[model samples]
Target chain A: MKNASSFCLLLVSLITPSLWPIIGHADGVFAFSPEQAIHVRTLAASCAACHGTQGNAMVKEGGNTSEENNPVLAGRTREDLLSKLLGFRDGTRKATIMHQHSRGLSLEEIDLLATHFSMQIRVIRPPLSPQKLEAEHG
Target chain B: MAEPFNRRAFIKAIGATGLVLASRPSLAMASKPPMGRVVIVGGGYAGATAAKYLRLWSLGAIEVVLVEANRQFVSCPMSNLVLGGSKSINDLTFGYEALQANHGVIFRHDTVTAIDAAAKHITMLGGTLSYDRLIVAPGVDFNYQEWPMLASLDAQKQVPHAWKAGWQTVNLRQQLETMADGGVFVMNVPKAPYRCPPGPYERACQVASYFKQHKAKSKVIVLDANAEIISKKGLFAKVFNETYAGIIDYRPDNAISHINLATKTVSTEFDSVKADVLNFIPPQRAGKIAQEAGLTEKDYPWCDVNFLTYESKLVPDVYVLGDSVAAGLPKSAHMATNQAKVCASAIVQLMSGSLPDVAPVFANTCYSFINDHAAMHVANVYRYDAGKKMMVSAEGGGVSISPNEKEAGYAHAWANNIWADTLS
Candidate 1:
């Protein structure tokens, strides 16, 4: 038993040296905790409705806002979205439509929504080609 | 051989102890008593950024307190567009929630009355607060005396500086709105070493462009105090000529000597000009608090600091940053934010008994929106020289010229990025 335990200990020490640093380093970068992740997920549902699954796409038919005016939010950094959201929430960002929507969110909700949207993949459609526009016109 | 315990039991005990020891480091970190308090004055880009970074690098070890006179901060970064009627004041305003929630910084919405540097305490309207380190970034205070006629508070009612964000900007916009077609709008730029050197010119361009579009007959006259305008000179001048050719009359080296508010005219070194609206941005010094703390020279309202560490030369454990420090950098929001980060890191190192390495990279980018679609940007990377005790720009660091009108539009986009980088 003693010899088997010694062998297991040796194996564990060897494995940990390689894997521990990566996990420890990753842990150090998290500014949020596990509870905060749950809060963010709940807050991101409103955005998910228009932005589509995980903020991946814009609603093609239901988006009444002009494309030139509305900014797509997928793939933006957490800090960027938080700042804009907070600005809108506080009435500092000043959008006619977004101001009201942002105001409805609590500060914690804003933070959560920001975190969730920030984690999604950004998908940007290419600018409409003139050729495509011409074909549609015809 | 005799073993004190069974091999399995001994091995399990060791593993549990190792896990405990590994967790102990974080526990030890959490148990450390919070160190000396830091009081940061001003909630603008400089003070706010300093407070956030200080808390960040301290790793929850230091107490940070921010004293701002106003409840909210309205950025001057793109206030010119407000004058052009392109953007609203709401677009420029930002709250202090992010710094408070994310960074654990205490915010005090009160004016700082005095700085008792000898005692390392600051007196605000509410009460006196002590600090282990005090960072002053109260921004610029205009010298109304430079224009004798408009020197008094009553005279300010007639001619507006609109330098500080918010109400002043709104007033200036309202004045522009009421002016008649074919009316003359006069703007005077003070001498060098003023806050946001390119600001007055950008304001002129925006106002002139607006006039050209809405009231083509109205003219905007810019009177410069210096021999040459400092930033984005070629691009701005080219756009001025091509787009609003006759609307903007620019005169360089024409300093305003006096103003007659009753007569509604200005006396410049070149000549006297009468106008419907007069905008004067006077030479400015650091806020009065900086002067009282002995952080400023005569006529200068800022302290001299090691640009790398932002530590004061005259005082210990006190740092001066942003527009209040006589750091050889452009007094832009971007520069202030960068300087704050450097200062925060250095402060952390100082508290930890660790010597910081020299020569940190401080960078700044200033974007000027000539029109709604056109803009220009100047960015530079700077380093501190130990021998000279000064912050100097690295060679090949300067403004990037906009390729064409289309590219200039990116300047407006750059404004969004810059604002996000600093306040967000």
Candidate 2:
């Protein structure tokens, strides 16, 4: 194994200075306590696998107008996020898999997630090109 | 008492040592001091997600050290497409650079040798590190106890398992490519409760899809240990019987009894199977690190954990994630990342003297491609059942009505977003 003890220490010393700006922007509008914020943020983070981190869903270059596009969630108005989520929950709207997810959460939790996502600063990434593959990756 | 290793003192020490510290831009100063350090083993979907979320949720309070044996991550979720010839191993492979550079996670490319849980220290091949909490997200390890002869590294190169999505994946693809027309390709599914329940069937579809387009005379035989198809049974059956009728032969309840490596033949109780290329996915259990750390039960192969925190029921302050955890759910990549988020949130709260969320709810959506262009999905939402102390599937969870080309785009998009989520 490669020893990186000193490098690890250097990385640690640099973390606080580099990471604070991304995280320090306080979302003071949450009606819940700080503890509840942790829970909701985690719940919202689960969506990142399909949606991009902070709900900025990735788009193929030149904009993919396919049924496959995952809707961007960050910076959407709170009312829109809540209504759409509630629709998915109450069967008022049709979806591929969103209903299954929305149905699992309570109305309050859904509202929290909606508010949480709306607060995120959406960074629509530069149009991404598909990854190219070769026979020998190494 | 010894002095606490405060940030100022640590930076001063590094400065004294003349070590060059890399930085981007200084931000608003953190109000709280460092709470603790978390050392995570394994850099797959689960561990990588946990490390990222722990830092993000904690606001740079808790330090994260991610130790992974491999420098690059190769996803198993899309590896089947490589067999279908629509993708390659290079497409699935990614480096940890973004995960480290962006998140400020201390990336250690090392292998764990031993774990002293009582001392809260992990002994790696390079050096020992102490942690307040440890997350063991090592994925499944193949169990070759039944056929020890095939366990060796050299033997694996000959009859590839190709289950873990690495060199063996490339090896298996090459074998399929070089096989003569009309040649038979045989693959066996290990018993259920293994990693990715639907993966074997998906592999069959991928191979059959390749044969249909290229080698029309080639045959794909699936020898499953289960009584029937384990997951998405109806959909897979439709694809096998209707989509690739003559090309695919799916035989259920035919577990491998013995293998003749010299002749590339496999024997089950009822019949003998001779193949031009053989892909045998053996039985699997919690990864070797989990077993060595005493995270798994004595009788069972998987680990038992507190459903809310994913902290091991066997080991205190040590959590298990991903396919290693014994759950009644499918061990898909999405499921693994969801579990990691829950675990990361719980640990952050626990470190800060706050209670972890009790009623954790998450969703799992897994897609299976019938061919290169058509795909289907099985989606479910899981809620923590306080009574059972486990995650149970919620209502409104179901499979796609049928495979379609539209869902295929969604599948690839899902892969892209997940790769970015876990790594970047």
Candidate 3:
């Protein structure tokens, strides 16, 4: 399997640049190794379905964007996020769904998630506009 | 017996390898690495989420093309509210503009006619697209073998399924609106492993809520093929028995044996029911595209996948997601998006010559509204089980004790956040 992988790598190097676009200059560089960054990003995205992408949770129209509305986790201090996650895991922090989620995660994973969200840059994005239903919908 | 990897599969796998090694030298020079294109079919929750995350996690390094038949996204999650009159299809509809604008994902509003897996190219109505990796997330297609009479589009117009949350949803809502006060609204629940286990029950509640508000004399007859409720049993049972006691007639283990469209009647082994508005949600399998691509097994309707990467067990370089995947987990929108994220992560890692997370963990949260402003949820965290080679439910995961208004607030917030997360 190892030999096959290396062979595949060699073939990829010879073929991919011809099929795909090459960067003119190095851009969108990663600080962490490619694998580590992808692992953490995938984990963080699991929370995105409810918490907005990168923990910038969106609120209802005309609703306040405070902690009351699914509280934004991005750009917070690491200590604050870690303490809250630990509290949720330990049953100290009361939550409707967080407790259920936090209890299943390992302590190490919770700490990692806290650090992941803390590093994200929070931006107050405009809420997406809902499209009208078509007269003849499929 | 391992099937030999085709030349197309080898090329894709190598493309992934190129993404890794090419970037290493580029990183040393403080530049970005070159990456290959990924073509995703069916832009529902699974495909759309995959497209967005592939671009997001790859930081615009990878080219992602999303091919969808529809112009807008109609959510199957909150779509039940459309039947109860609490929300409109418009409120649940969204365009792909955000995904294209924010994530730089290429959007193609065209239907895929055929997928040549061995060639790594798709033949669509408009044109052909080649890719290094293919993600097929076509949700579900209703099975009509048993009731061949209801297979036609015209038949669906009268006895609608409304399962996909589009034209059928509108048709069903209109049928209910025009129904007399004393009319009977009959709907059936397909057997287990259908899309959204709690969905049929929630639809019954929505129809009942609508009837209770406008037509006091109307009745809702729920004919479930399963022996009992498959999801949120305690909560759904309580709501059916107590809240809509007189309005809802809950019948279990009553599989449909025959349908008489002219008579507006459905027959089981021992019973025959006629209704003013008939909702027939037939048993389902993977979408036709997956079936055509030879993704599903000979006996099973769903495509088997490695839960870690959601890569097809049958085909190399072809990943399956959403309701199309055969799994023990509930086929909910949240589960589909989570699977998409995991698949996207694996693809990114694979392209860069690194191994995917061996112990991938994720959560699935599903909210079912009992009414316009009251809801309940079932949530769980699942981790990859090495022995089973699939995701298994972890500890501390279950359903809500009861339906309440607070969850309703969270439910709407969930819709907004997930939409933004998926599209923007």
Candidate 4:
């Protein structure tokens, strides 16, 4: 038993040096790095409902009723988009809808969404011809 | 194939490796450099708060230098009330003496001419200064050329963009004072990417409130460049419709295209509107210093940096904060102050050879006063997202008070708290 205790102590001493690697791994997991694309993709799952799969924003025939007060972010500059998201998150660009959506997001999620949307090609969706929609519905 | 590591062994391994890594040359290099100096530009909310927090966290290990072009920072946050005559400019003005005495910040009253990011040195009108880490928060500069009509000398003389603090604010207020009782005061709200998104609406509310009291015959018309006004829209509309019914007219989705200053008329994409007094808030970007440093993207002013550390991605040992950074934080004094604290803490950790485990939580409370006695507030918390390279908001974030008298009173108190927290 004494020999086992000494052996365990020796083993503990040998294992101590490896502790930094674990800490380093933890730091890697937590650190805000540029290559967290997978994590970003996972976080962006929640945004697919409104922003669409890749942030192309799925606008229904009636328009986004939930976001009627806000403009659809289909195609905008990354800087412009990021600023708006920041504003919404910080309550600087307050809207009941955006405030709720933004408040739930972490900074990482915001960055991920901003990055994902920032790279999206700007495609101007022609405004719905109101008369045509009305006639079709009628 | 390998045996499962027990908890004690795992902990011991972690502890031992931490010690070894702690003894590495790189880790040792993280120790506080010999009296490292931080030179910050701009003395507004960002710079002042940064200097204070840096001093606090460093415990007098780092030297804090603040360079400000203006003698005093006249807060742009609540200056709308000043225009409405509900408050004085004196109430908005704050000096750096308290900051210097209490925080041990070295204040240099000078304009920054250029920043040599390569050398980590900044050239100023007064002298050249070197910094271990430079924090640039020079606020914003208006792009008059964005609207050609407003850029013309004749038009500029008549229409004022009181977006920037100091003379601009005073000029706009004076123009309002000179307007006839029945004159129309036209305020233009620029599109996104402008400083203080809610500012224009807040200004309109205050102006409408003022006209109700002093210039009842005069009406304030808001021509917005965006599809919708930002923040507290329901509350603002309700208050305006109920309290200042005929005094205020709001139009969104109306982008101002031109201004015929000769005739005091402005043209938007939709229609033309005439005014006796026009306040045009043009689109904005980061300041010139940031642009010269190659820190800005195409038309956007400001450097892209790690939101948690405020460290420039392009330049090492250089931090960018406030409106000058593409931080996924609001461009408000409150957000800037929190960002300054985060940056300061990160700098401390980097210098002290210790890992900072503290998670950064940024809080912002924006208060908009509908009238002298009543106000509205919105607050939120923000955290960093490395994967997305952005900041995101918490879900189910802050709410405006539900039109209760008690809440209104609290809103007033909140405003007082904001003013004290920012300036005092």
Tens-digit lDDT string for candidate 4 (B1-424): 2212234532342343344336544444433433577889887777776776676556556777888887666767777887878776666666666556544567777788988888778888867888888888877766766677776545655777777656566667888888889999998888776777678888998888778888889999999887776776787778768877888888988888877777888888779989988888888777777777777777556579876678888778778778777765567776776677677777866776654423455446676777665666666656565577567675466657544344444433333333333332
Q: Please write out the lDDT profile of model 3 over residues B140-242, one tens digit for every residue.
A: 9899998899999999999999999888898899999999999999999999899999999999999999988899999999999999999999999999999
lDDT of 1 at B371: 74
lDDT of 1 at B275: 83
Candidate 4 chain B has its poorest 10 consecutive residues by lDDT at B1-10
Q: Cα miss at B362, model 3 (Å)? A: 0.6
Candidate 2 lDDT tens digits, B236-279:
99999999999999999999999998899999999998999999
Stretches off by above 4 angstroms in model 1 are A1-138, B1-31, B152-154, B299-301, B403-424
Instruction: Go through the candidates in order and give each one's DockQ.
Output: 0.02, 0.27, 0.41, 0.05
lDDT of 3 by residue, A13-111 (tens): 345332123223222221444444655677778898778888998865576444226778898865567677766766666788888988888655665
lDDT of each: 0.66, 0.82, 0.83, 0.64
For residues B1-424, could you state the per-residue lDDT of candidate 1 as single tens digits? Answer: 1112233532342343344335546543433345667889888877887776666556556677889987767778878999998888777776666566545677777888888788888888888888888898888878766567776656665788888767678778898899999899999888878889889888988999789778889999899998887777887777667777898888899998878888779888769999898888888888777777787777555678887688888877778878877876688776777677777777876776765536554445566877776666665546567788787775434454542444343444334444433433
Ranking by lDDT: 3, 2, 1, 4
- Which residue pairs show collisions in model 2? none
The segments of candidate 2 whose C-alpha lies over 4 angstroms from its true place after superposition are: A1-28, A33-36, A126-138, B1-30
What are the chain A TM-scores for all the models, listed individually?
0.54, 0.68, 0.68, 0.51
